[model samples]
Target: MPVPPATRTSPGAKAPTRPPVRRRERQIGGSQRRMADLQPGLDFTNVALRPYANVERMRNELLRCYLLSPPASEIPEAISPFTVQYISCVLATYPRCMLSDGGLPPLVHRAQVQGQEMPRALANCFSLVRMWYQAVPGSEAMVAGMVEQEMERLAGKPPGQGDYILLCTFQAYLLYSIMIYFSPLPNTSALKYKTMITLSELACRTVRNGFSCAAEHSHTRPPWETWIVAASKRRTFVTMELFRIAFNAGRLLPSSVTSELGDIFASGNRALWEASDRDSWGREHDRYLLDWEDGMLNTSELYRPEATAQKERVERWVQSVDEFGMMLFAVCAHIRGR
Candidate 1:
């Protein structure tokens, strides 16, 4: 075959070649086309940003009001004004999806109307937590001073004070420790851990002493009001133990604390605790205690294969009692090694 006459080309000329189109370029083009198809008037700038500005303004107003107003003296001891304010702030700051239905407002309202008496130490703890939340200047020192005063007050009390008082003290200490541990302050991790350990130990000791007194009256059926107090003490102790185990992963804390209280061994049956009237509570108490003591329904039975069915029953019971009861079940399950 005769070679074709050389294709005409200028000196130093190169053949043209198409550049490869990248995947990213194609994607950008597709997205641009899709965006172009949408209506240009559909602007979301104000719709997205206006709520945030509104929230910021509302928060500033709330803080200003709270700071300017004189502290409320008539508020019940059982209710912490700081906690209520903190909760209100949270609700105002976040979207609805991030918030709970009511957060602690109902409890505060009840405390106000009923004139419920709260333990002094626990009240102080709430104050300390509120300070932490506010993050005011010198809050740490203020918290420390308050905690020291509380500790001294607790120390000065007679060793044989009522179980109710002692239980309150322990809970207060635990709450203080928890608040400090999770605080946003920097350079406090060591202090937080130490505080947690010390408080846990103190709580264990207090529980031992307080519950010993509670056991003496356990044999008799007390009035509905008295029984509620006793039940609260038991629940508080168990809750402390659960928190200890969870925080330390059962390594630093023992699996269980020493206690002879029957409440610890009882099923997570909330009916007994939820009885509205004295007569109903008394009746439910008897039945519940009887069921607890019955050999067939002990805590050991909760771990068996048949216990799977019981889980649903416990869940159903929790429906009537709400979150507190569910928490009880969760602690119970953990205790049973489930």
Candidate 2:
């Protein structure tokens, strides 16, 4: 097939193929070459960089295993390793979040004036919980001391005080109570359980006094602050109720001590619970209300259609709920024999 000397292909002609080994080499080095060749196009402005990026990664890992999973069949004899790691990350990354002054961290204070107290207190309890779990010297005594201090603080304040502070106090009390109840130490179960029950009663009363049930006619989305406060109150109430049922089982407490679950199903919308920002929250809240008006089911009643052919719908809803919601749902199902 020898003809005139083979003409050279122009640079603009169809691209030539590389040898197999050369192609493999290019594939292996492609990413590195691209990275080396990349140039900045535009600089970002007003971007809020996370101060604890490494800690955030740890938190994400812990959440993926614990909060993202279904509740276990039984509470572990000790806290899970993931929880311990998460607590360590939180303590290391955001030490100011656990300050005992009940003041908000500077960054948090700048963002909002209220609702920061509960989170701070909860963070403190988490730190204490880690210490207790690790059996650190004097950690048990420290937790007990904090419990006493909180009790005294509550006793000194009248119920007529601001609902914001009351809510925060109740939340802290709830966390501390649970911590005490679940301590690994022996010879403390009776006292801890009694304390837990008492705190549960107090928390329920605080909810009733501080937050009103969402009115059936109130179809409009409220401001973020107001909506979040209501949502926290409702969630706290439901959590305490679930704990009480699970702990007491066949035993019945006095009416004054027991929480009435009237209209509890009218809690915050799942979309509102899951929203990350004010605008998104508002959109989700509105969408949820619209769905509600159109006869959407509540989370508590979601499992009622087991005999129906809506298996896919049930699975989707189950996956939609967050960890806390899933835990509550699990408790309800346990109580109802579902």
Candidate 3:
């Protein structure tokens, strides 16, 4: 044992130790593989931005459809140059949200739009409205058929041509507004969908009631235009009904879905009002009663900001069914002008 230390190492011998590292081999290969797997770019930090994004997108569509159709009287006169410019400017986010081939449609992007070289979904929307203007009677039926065609092309996938849905919805609201104004008897029975009537269907029922009333009493020669207006209103009503439910449901559904739905409803309602001939309100209302009701709705609007969150926020959204009643009343009043 005493002789071991001297014998263990010759004068130039070295102690056992790890080998020196080479410059190129500093890292273990497996670590680099794991890091690559984790970094493929799937993230969702921008969820809150979604609603605003969809609103902006739909606003553009509304503006575009409005321009394409123009007022029947003003058509062939260079579609309002200002309106086109305004919509284009307002919808600046569209390029980011535009759909691409072999990917989801515009609506499906949730937060971000991605793709390359696909036909613009907005183009389909303009075509639907243009077709509606062309078809005199059964315009609703024709538009519905066209929308179904777009739906089929998208094959139950997200971002498939849903702007058509918006068009249908807006038209329905117009119908409901008409019904509230003209019809003495409410057509509540027709409000059910497949099994249960959709909100749009309810709007249709109201508009149909108005159309019946207008046909019976108005001096307008072709009552079919009344019916067409009624049908458009009905479609819009149904859409808003669905949207109210979705918006109220909030967290129950994906935020993206609700946001888009809200955006559609807001823009659709505005468009319906703008496109309508306001001076075209047919008969005068009982002045005294009209003023009273107007005051109530105006007051309600003042409180709407406070109610917006209470009515549409996630925790309280579902409980906000009462809000729909208000919307219905307001829409009815607008159509009736009372």
Candidate 4:
């Protein structure tokens, strides 16, 4: 999915609202100390959820960070590739969502699903409040505030309702945003104008804390791996899988940073297998193999022996799937209507 033209400080779009408060700077390592003393639990009782709401706001903040960040090819060696790869996942999904029409493909719709299931999966993946508190002790209050704000945004109130899936999506957005901000080198100054130093620090804190929590709880695997396991164990598992997909895709992103991007939708529901059909995603993923086998790949698009052949391939894929199919109908009725 191509990014909408109006993302950046659109003319007359509202300026970023001020955060609730700013406090005296913590000692450089205070947060780590606090995190060490925190506890881990399942309940988010009495926790405010406002900042977690306004899905659009969170999405846009991520977009600004990703699409407008420095080019990956030009990133100084001081930056870690893991961080860059993480952000790329965020940027990749927007186009994917639009193309797949928010994951309402024919095969996915055929799988009987209950509406609440998706949100439940999201909630499970993001309900790491306990881990977050303990992992980044000094930043607990601030993290809590951010969570509250997001929950309120989701609930359509000053303080929104919090859920697992929503938070997972938001986190996914964060990772993808960071990756894309540096993926390409399109006019550097125009894209790099936004200041991510603060957001980056916060992101680093959140991820590092998450890592620490995972380490304490499950010593067998890396934090990201542990997160994947936890999310999978939850009632809602799609969110974790989505993150997994993004992570895998990032590994395939070359240092060239010139891959063409477009939309490719998959299941938004947890019960459904994203690429159950061998025809679409599986085959498409496989094509990359052929591209590697032969140096004929022109950037990321398939080389057309003739442009007409390329056009036909697209048309066949599009025609095979219902543009106004049953799956899409549900999305419009349930997701869009919401």
Candidate 5:
């Protein structure tokens, strides 16, 4: 082999070295730093779950820096792409389908006209949360004190509740958490700590029960039901990531908790997710390559260095991920790039 060209140096100097991929520690969870035993359905109580200081820092940072900051002028590019992408996910999910990211298309109509009390109640509460943001700014803890109490009550509900109810409860806490951090309401100081605890509880509950109904294929379950599972899983994982990055708060969470996010399956196939009925979802899902037919992507595969080994296939999977899934992708990529 030919000798490699040597750099011409007049004086003694160190050779340049490639920079590191990360500095302090690999904060974002993907291919690194996960506990092996902390798989899904395990007893979360056994895990060493501890609250980190970063949650409050993030809550304040987002509220003061992002939400309460003055309106932007000049270029429209003032907004971060990540912020825009996340907003798209929120708008897609809320009011229309409160539980799943991007909202489930089939139930969007039915839930409006003939939905159950829990879902319907969610619809109304969702509107109030949205309206609170739109309405004139005021004090009083963002929402009524009773709202927090109700959410507390809902969260403590028995374990045997239906998937739908569990998901709805998860949504209420999530919505209230948003108001607690971002909404320009008074008394946030009072509810902030309580909200943080509730959030962790909700995260654990969501992980344990939210996607429990999911299946690997449509053969045994209807496309609609699986779609819900897929959306729920994706949303929950991304929310955890958002919590991590939004304040460096996630830095305090144990690797076991963070690692679980990657092990779960994320929904692929946007067409199927958006399919209005069983027939359309079946057809679209069937058209996918055998490997991706179920559209069940192991999320860990998403953050690996060789994640794009299958570029075209990966592209299809990335496109299929819902709004919150996209956020998860962005957060992981953002941290890894650093």
Candidate 6:
């Protein structure tokens, strides 16, 4: 074979070579997934769309969480009359989310909040939080220790009584954590280190005993009871990571709960969650329950909508969730913001 003359090269230029085949093969192979891994032949039509009935109300609440600060719209009286504006308003007026609601009837017969009695644990937490707000005479050690003791009560396995206690305990913990984090009390700093440990214990509990009613919906379980069990667990589980982000991100920075942790629980339809009676929950809410598999509303799904079938059903699921569900949406939205 005859040799060709070499071409001139720039001073810094190096000789060209063939493309990297192995690197490309590895990159392409990583993209490949098994057909069975994708779970073909599944009904995954929703994987059934449970459209939220209260579209307008749901929209308003989502806007409120994502947009409203200092909570101007629903403020009663004048803003000038307040001591602590946001805290006072949140305590008095912020709509109850599942974390706070504990799957109970706030409106008895779907009426007024009077029908539901405050959980005793929560009532006690309120008193403890009061000490934070009022600057009642107490040492940093005393206040932080008191809060720690309360958290300790719920730290290990839940009571033998079951989900009801579990729900209330978490509600109490949520109140405790939020109040301390936002409180002006000197002890708030003391709690910073402690909050991490408390959060870890909570995460373990969610993994071990989080959803007691993770079974398929049936005549055996009342619609309301099952919804409460799952939502409470999801709310608490998500909140722990929510706090973790809030802590690490500066007293002054924040990771989202869902994407960081592979939580697959769904926030079910609101009508079913709020229904005061079994007859009221209706078939629509009952028809699609959170199964352990296809039906789960994984946090990852926020990024991968294609895995789900119906857009409207997803909207309904997103809208139907109580404030706790809205809280998760807010976190997911922040993830996209980053």
What lDDT tens digits, residue by residue, belong to model 4 across residues 159-186? 1223323334334333223323333222
lDDT computed for candidate 3:
0.30
- Candidate with top lDDT is 5
C-alpha TM-scores of all predictions = 0.49, 0.53, 0.21, 0.23, 0.57, 0.53
For residues 86-144, could you state the per-residue lDDT of candidate 1 as single tens digits? 32332222112112322221111111111134457655655555555565666656655
- Per-model root-mean-square deviation over C-alphas: 22.6, 17.4, 23.7, 23.2, 24.0, 23.6
Which candidate achieves the best TM-score against the true structure? Answer: 5
Residue 43 in candidate 2 has what lDDT?
Answer: 19
lDDT of 3 by residue, 1-338 (tens): 45655536677889667788756522221233232232234232211111122333433332332233434564231223343333233222222222222221112211111112213444454354345334556455655556445534433233322332333333323223222222212222221122112332333223322312232223232222232233333334333433333322321321111122221212112221222222222222222123223221211232243544433332222222232333433442332233
Question: Per-model C-alpha lDDT, please?
Answer: 0.42, 0.44, 0.30, 0.30, 0.47, 0.45
lDDT of 1 at 338: 47
Better of 1 and 5 by lDDT: 5
Question: What's the lDDT for residue 324 in model 5?
Answer: 47
- Model 6, 142-209: lDDT tens digits are 77777778777766545443444555665567556656665546634544555555555444433344
RMSD of 4: 23.2
lDDT of 5: 0.47
Runs in model 1 deviating more than 4 A are 1-117, 148-152, 187-201, 209-221, 250-263, 267-321, 331-338
Clashing residue pairs in candidate 1 (N, C-alpha, C atoms within 3 angstroms) = none
Worst 10 residues of 3 by lDDT: 44-53
> Which 10 successive residues of model 5 have the least lDDT summed?
42-51
Cα deviation of 303, candidate 2, in Å: 7.2
TM-score of 2: 0.53
In model 2, where is the ten-residue run with the lowest total lDDT? 42-51
